[model samples]
Target: MSSALPPASSGQPPVAASPLQPVTAGILTALVGFGSTFAVVLQGLAAVGASPAQAASGLMAVCLAMGVLGLGLSLALRMPISVAWSTPGAALMAATGAVQGGFAAATGAFILAGGLIALAGFWKPLGRMAAAIPPALASAMLAGVLLKLCLSPFTAVAVAPVPALAVIVTFLVVGRFFRLWAVPAAVAVAIGLTLAGPGSAGFDTAALALPKPVFVMPAFTLEAAVGLALPLFLVTMASQNIPGLAVLSAFGFRPAAGPLFRATGLGSMVIAPFGGVTVNLAAITAALAAGPDADPEPARRWIAGVTAGVAYLGLGLLALAAAAGFGASPPLLIQAAAGLALIGAFGASIAGALKEEADRPAALVTFLFTASGLSVAGIGPAFWGLVAGVAVMTLHGRLGRLTHP
Candidate 1:
C-alpha cells in the first residue's frame, strides 16, 4: 500500500494498486478453467433432466464461456471478485425438482428466486442487515448449512472403489502438496481417471453431442410457485449468498453485492431458455478463486474473481459442450464430494451461531430447526428455523426490557 505515485505537492499519497501479472492473476484463472465451472456444469445438468450427451454439451459450453469471461472480466475490473454458478443453487434445483415439476418450471422458479435476490441486494437496509449479521454466526450458519455436501464422497467411495478413491486421494494429496492448486490437481486426476476408465474405454464421444433445450413451457401452478420458488430463493440467499459476501470480505476484497446479484440474475435469465436454468455466485468456488492464495497479494486476487466471472459467461454460450459432458459423473461421487466440502462449512456455521455467550441459545434454535430437515409447504427448514430463532429471541428481549425498564 505504498503512496509513492503521489507527488509531495499533492499532500495525499496515491493508492498503490496491485500489479496484474500472469502468475498472479492468470494462474488463478487457469486453475478454475475446469476446477470450478466444469464441476458446477456437471452438478447443474444432473439437477435438470440432461442426459449424458446434454451434459457434455452443457459442460463444454459453460467451461469455455466461463474461462473467456473470467479472463476478460478479471482484466477489466482489476479486482479479483469472481462469480460462478451456485452449487447450492443447483442442488436446490435437484431437490425441488424431485419434489415438484419439470425443468422449464424450475427455470421459471430460478428466475423468480433471482429476482428476490436482486430485491434484497437493492435495498440499502437489507444489504446492511445482511452485512451486519454477526460475522461468526454468518460463518457458522454457512458451515452448518453446507455440512451435508462435504460428506457425500464416502458413500460413493464405499460403493465404487476405483473412481471415488482416486478423486478423493488426489484432491487431498495434491491439496496438501500444492496448496495453491490442489483442487485443480485433484480434478486433473479425476479427468485422467475418467479417461482411463477402470477396465473399459473412457469418454464415449458420440455421447458428447450438441444439446438443444427440450423446451418445456412452464406451467406455474400455485404448487410450483409455493413449493419451488420459495425454497430456491431462501437457500440461494441464506445458505449461499450471505456466506459468499462474507468470504469475499474476509479475503480483503469488497463484496459488490449489487453487481454480483445482478450479473448472476442476468446470467440465469440468459440461459434460462436453453435448458440452462439457474446460475449464481459460487460459494466454494468463490472461496477458491478469491482466497489470498489465488494470488500472492490480497489486492491482486480480485482479478481472480473477475476471471471466474468471465469464465461463467463463457460457460453460458457453449450449450453443446455443456450437454455433452455434464452427465458422466457418478451420483454417489457428487454427493460425497459436495458433502465433504460442506462439512467444515456446516460446523463453522453452528459455531458462529453460538459463539457469543449471548447468542448461544439462538444458535441452538437455528441449528435444531435447520437440522430438522422439515419442509413447510415445500419451503426448506432453514426459513422456518430462522424465523423461530429470531422470534424467540425477540420475545425474550422484549420481556426482559419490560422487567428492567
Candidate 2:
C-alpha cells in the first residue's frame, strides 16, 4: 500500500503546504498577540477611568487600527510588518491610574501622545530625542511600571488561591511545552474559572451586545500631558516601535521606520476619540509573520502579515465578548492573568536594565523611583523616574570629569 504522506511528515516536523503556511502563521500571530496582552489593555483603560463601555470600545478600536494599518503597511511595503497595541503603554497607564481630569483628560493625553509619535516619524529632532534616552533608563522605567502588575499573580493567590494557582500552573506547564501558547492557556483557564463562578450568567447576555465606540471629547491639562502623554509616548517608542524595527531588521526586511511610525501614530489619533489609547509596530509577534517559519522564501512572508491583519479585524468583532468575560471576573483574577502575560517582558526589561554595570546606578534609581508610585507636583512616577535617573547620571558625569581633570 502506498501512503499519501509528504516525506517531511514521516520523521521531521510536518511542514505546512506553501499556500497555507502564511495563513497559519498569520492566524497564530493574531491569536498569540491578542490573547496574551489584551487584559492589560482593558485594565489600563479602566484604571485611567474608562467605564466598561469605554474600555470595550478602546479594545475594539485598537484592534481595528492595528488590523487596518498592518494590512496597509504589509501590502504597500511587501514586508511582514505587524502592528499591535502598546502593552508597556497600557501598563504605564495602569500604574499612573486616574489623572486629574479623568478619562476625558486621559483622552487628551492620548491625542498628545499620538501627535508626538507622528512627529517623531517626520521630525528628525523629535525622533532623535527619543533615541537619545539611555537604553538602561528606558528599560528600567518599563520594569518599574510592570512591577505592580507582575506581582498580581502572587497577590491573587492570597485573594483566590484555587483559581490563581490553576492559572499559574497551567502557565508553567504550557510554557514548558509550547512557550508561545502559555499566556493564552493561562487566560483560558482564568476565563473558565471566572465564568464558572456564580453570577456569571450575566456574561452571556453582555457578550451578545456588540462593541460600540464611545467618543470622549479631548480635554488637555498640563498634568495629563506631562504625566500621562509624555511617559506613554516614551514607553511606546522604547518598548514597541524601536524593538519592532529591530525585529524586522533581524528578519532581513528593512522597510523604512518613518512610514511605519507615521501610520501607527496617525491610526492612534484617529482611534483616540473612540477610546483607543495607542497602537504601534509589533515587536514580539512580528517574528511570527516575518520569520522563516512563515515561509521558506522571505519575499512571500507578507502574506502572513496580511493574514494577521485580517485576523485582528475578526478579533475586533469579539471585543464585547472579551470585555464582558474579563469584566465578569474578579479584578485580581484578571490581573493575575495579565501579570502572567507580562512576566516575559518584565524579565527582558530587567535584563536589559541591568546589563551595563556603568549605567546600573542610574537604571537602579529609575527603577526604584518609578516603582515607588511617587507623584510629585501631579507628575507621575514614570516622568519623575526618568528625571531622577537623568539627574543622577549628569551629576555623576560632572563629578567624574572634575576628579579626572
Candidate 3:
C-alpha cells in the first residue's frame, strides 16, 4: 500500500498529516511544567516544616487539582485554559521558612489565600485592588524572595564540587540547545548523582509506594495569616494568574476572567486540607498549549489543554517516587536544581522591578528589606517589605511637594 493520505471524497477539512501534533505539545508542556518546578514545591513545603509524607501529599494534591480544573475549564470554555500550581508562591514560602504554628498554620494560610482569591473573583473591587499593587514593589518583593534560593548553585558547588559541577554543566550545555529542557536535564543529573552518592544511604524504599493523601487539620495563626497568606495571594495573582491571562490574550484567546479565577481558587481550597498550597493559571507553560505549535487552528487547541490535564494526572501518580528520589538527594543538590529552574524568573523580576525610574527607589528599598530576612512581632520580611517601600514612596512625594511649594 502507498504511504499517503486518502483523498477527501466530500466537503470536509483536510485531515492533517499528523493528528498528534497537539498531543505531543501538550505532553511536552506537562513534562516541562512538572519536572521544572516540583523540586521547588517540595523544598518549599519542607521549609515550612512538612514531613516527607506531607510534602508528597501536597505535590499529589496540587497536581490533581490543576489537572481537574484545567481539563474541566478547557472543555467548558473551548479554549486552551491551562492551570498549574503557584510556583512563585511556593518560592516565597521557601524563603519565608516555618511560621509560628508550623506546617499546620501554613495549611491554614493556604486556605485563607484561596478564600481571598475566590473572593477577589466574586467581588470585582478586591480583584481590582489586588491588581492595583504597584508593579515595581511587587516585582521587587518577588526578586528579593528569590535572591537566596537563586544563589544555591554556587553554594552547592562549595558544599559538593563534583556533583554540583556535573549538574551545572548539564544545565548550561542542554540550555544552549534546548532551553525548555535545561532544568529538567539538570534535575535528571542531580537525581542520578544522589543515587550514586552517599546521600543514598538514607533513602527509604517504602517511600516509593503509591501516595496516600495526608490531611493536616489547619491551625490558623495571626503570624501565618499576615506573613504567609497575604504574600502568597499577592504573588500568585500578580505573578502567575495575571501574566497567564496576558499570555492567552496575546495568543488571541479571551476567556472570561472571573470563572477561571474562581475555579482555581475553589480548587485550591478544596485541596488545602490535604497539604496542597495554591493552584492557579499556568504562566510559563500556558504558551505551550495556546500557541500555534499546539495546533494550526486556534479553535482546536483546547485539545492540548485537555491532554495536559491528563498528563498531569499521570505525573501525579509518580509523586511518591519523586519524593523518594529527592529524599535520597542532598538538600543543596535539590536547592541548586530549584535555583537553576528559577534563574529566568529572577532575571525577569529584576528587570521588571527597575523598569520605571520613578519606582526604582521604592523597589530597591523593597528588595533590600525583603532579602534582609528580618522579622518583627511575628511578621516576616515579605509583609514588612511592602510597608517599607510604601513609606519611602510617601515620604519622597511629600518632600518633593514641599520643595516645589
List runs of model 3 lying over 4 Å from the truth.
Answer: 1-17, 398-405
Q: Which stretches of candidate 2 lie over 4 Å from their true place?
A: 1-17, 198-202, 398-405
How many steric clashes between backbone atoms does each model show?
68, 0, 0
Write down the lDDT of every candidate, Cα atoms only: 0.53, 0.90, 0.88
| Worst-scoring 10-residue span by lDDT in model 2 | 1-10
Q: What's the lDDT of the predicted structure labeled candidate 2?
A: 0.90
Give one digit per residue, the lDDT tens place, for model 2 in 223-298.
9999999999999999999999988888788888788878888899999988997999999999999988888777
Query: Candidate 1: lDDT of 332?
Result: 51
TM-score of each: 0.71, 0.93, 0.93
lDDT of 3 by residue, 78-97 (tens): 99889999988999999999
lDDT agreement of model 1 with the native: 0.53
* lDDT per residue (tens digit) for residues 370-390 in model 1: 555667775555555666666
Whole-model lDDT, model 3: 0.88
